[model samples]
Target chain A: MVIAAIGIAAAAALWRRDGAPAVGAALYHAWELFLFIAPSLLAGLLLAAALRQLVSPGALARWMGAESGWFGLAVATLAGALTPGGPMAAFPLVLVLAGAGADRGALVAYILSWALNGFQKLLVYEMPLLGPDFAIMRTLVTLPMPMIAGYIARRLPIAWEPPK
Target chain B: MTGGQVFLAVIALVAFGFCLRRGPGSARRAVVDTGQGLWKILPIFAVALPMAAFLAELIPADAAVAWIGPESGVSGVVVASFAGGLMPGGPFVTFPLVLAFAKAGAGVPQMAALITGWSIFALHRIITWEYPILGWRFVAIRLIAAAPLPIVAGLLAEAVVAVLPIGLGRP
Candidate 1:
């Protein structure tokens, strides 16, 4: 609210100063941001649904339920790969991961990484859009983020009790 | 599309259901009937493409960088995150938006951060789609957890670039 108010105020001020209309750069930016985000959401939803139907959750949990370690991290990442989309992408997978015995911390790890990248999304959307170089570079760097995320989730200091 | 391939997809899906099956599988039955294959899912993506195109018309690339670029790191991170969170659509246009920032002298940090912001952190989707289905608790958890993803993704991406075998150094 504060930022928007300031933005509007700045635009108003500028409009008053110059002979132009009150529309300003901030408003334009706000508009741009909105336009840019729409299509992918649609695509992600489509893919997410496909994923849910493809993989069964209980089996996925068994796979992901490997002993917690770096090995655990690999399992989570691979589970994420086999699973499609993020939390809201598909219903069954996310629910299965949550309900079918995937630990909360590991689920978080999977989700954070899963939500970010995967085969279909990267192969079709990102790698093509950003190009192979960008995709590969991003993959190399992000490979570690999930591990870090998974590690942090396991070592969580925050006191939220795990759901029974 | 071929009969054999359809046979394979079906076989794979059935195998998947039998092995890892949980949640709605017994009820839903089979791979072709799985979550992604439903007819109900295409509307959002179609809607998103036009909306994004219309939006980009308003905010040019130079301007986005000015507001969310790395010159102001903390503010940059926050703004980029929110911008991403606020959108109701796809990263298709956001990709160009990131490029726009980079073209306008935005740092790799800002571009990467903006991309992170754009991913799954969207606010409109959360409100309309996720909230009703999952409730506020999960929604809130996702939002709070995703808050810094953009910054972290950006910083780490930069770290990778700096140390790439090709290296980021001048020739």
Candidate 2:
């Protein structure tokens, strides 16, 4: 609501300066882009929600627990990529993993993987606007990043202070 | 639309069918979840997309190129990475702005850095989601571990662009 209001104000200001035609053109382009994106967004959200429901937290913990090692990190990364929704879905799962005794390394890998290479976001948003080449290149380049970060986090003795 | 779009559609369909086979209840729940997600995202789209278009209109192509285009070099990537982290909003907002930047002549490496920074270091997400849920210690460690990523990714992307043919950078 706030963002929309600010946008409206900005558009009105732009309209005053650039006149009606330019603003109209901009709006038309936005609508066109929206039309192209809506289906994919709907589809991606559906898939993400279904997957979220299907993958139980207990199962996630078992796969990514402290003793699970390198395989755990790999599984966590893959799961992070596949697990859908935004931070609301993700952070909760992180909490669940933490509570269920998942390894810190696996947790770090999971979050980083989701942040960098969320498959659903790529499918729905990135591929459409940025083109497949950019998307593919970005994906390939960032693929190993989470594991690298995970290993570093694992090696570092950063104190895990519990939340208030 | 594009091959990627078609591929995603097919994947969504398969997933939908699988959800249905699991049970009618699960399918219905998924649909409900989708609706809620759409509700949350649509307003951000409404604001961000038009704003992106407006930004493209306001910022001249030459200025965009000079600042973040192919010749802008490492500094451009650094600027883009920081700008991306500072950008507030989700994928619906950020990706459209990225498209706007691309249209206005930002380079592939810059865009790569932008996305990388947005994913890992977005301050808004860190304050709201990461800190509250995961605690400060976890957030700090993750930030330190991930700090070099965007710069590294940007440099690697630059190297790739140098090796590839002319049009490969755009599409």
Best candidate, DockQ: 2
- Each model's lDDT comes to 0.50, 0.78
Model 1 spans > 4 angstroms off: A1-58, A85-89, A154-164, B1-61, B69-78, B96-106, B128-146, B162-171
Q: What DockQ does candidate 1 have relative to the true complex?
A: 0.12
CAPRI docking class of candidate 1: incorrect
Model 2: per-residue Cα lDDT at residue B17: 86
Worst 10 residues of 2 chain A by lDDT: A52-61
List, residue by residue over A43-122, the lDDT tens digit for candidate 2.
66676677765665346667777678788888888877866768888888887777777777888888989988887687
| Shift in Å, residue A164, candidate 1 | 9.6
List, residue by residue over A10-79, the lDDT tens digit for candidate 1. Answer: 4455556553432444345444433443233333333444454555434656655426667666666666
The candidate scoring highest on lDDT is: 2
| Residue-level lDDT tens digits of model 2 in B2-118 | 555566668777887888999999889978987887887687777887987777776677778988898899999899888878988788777877887887888889999999999
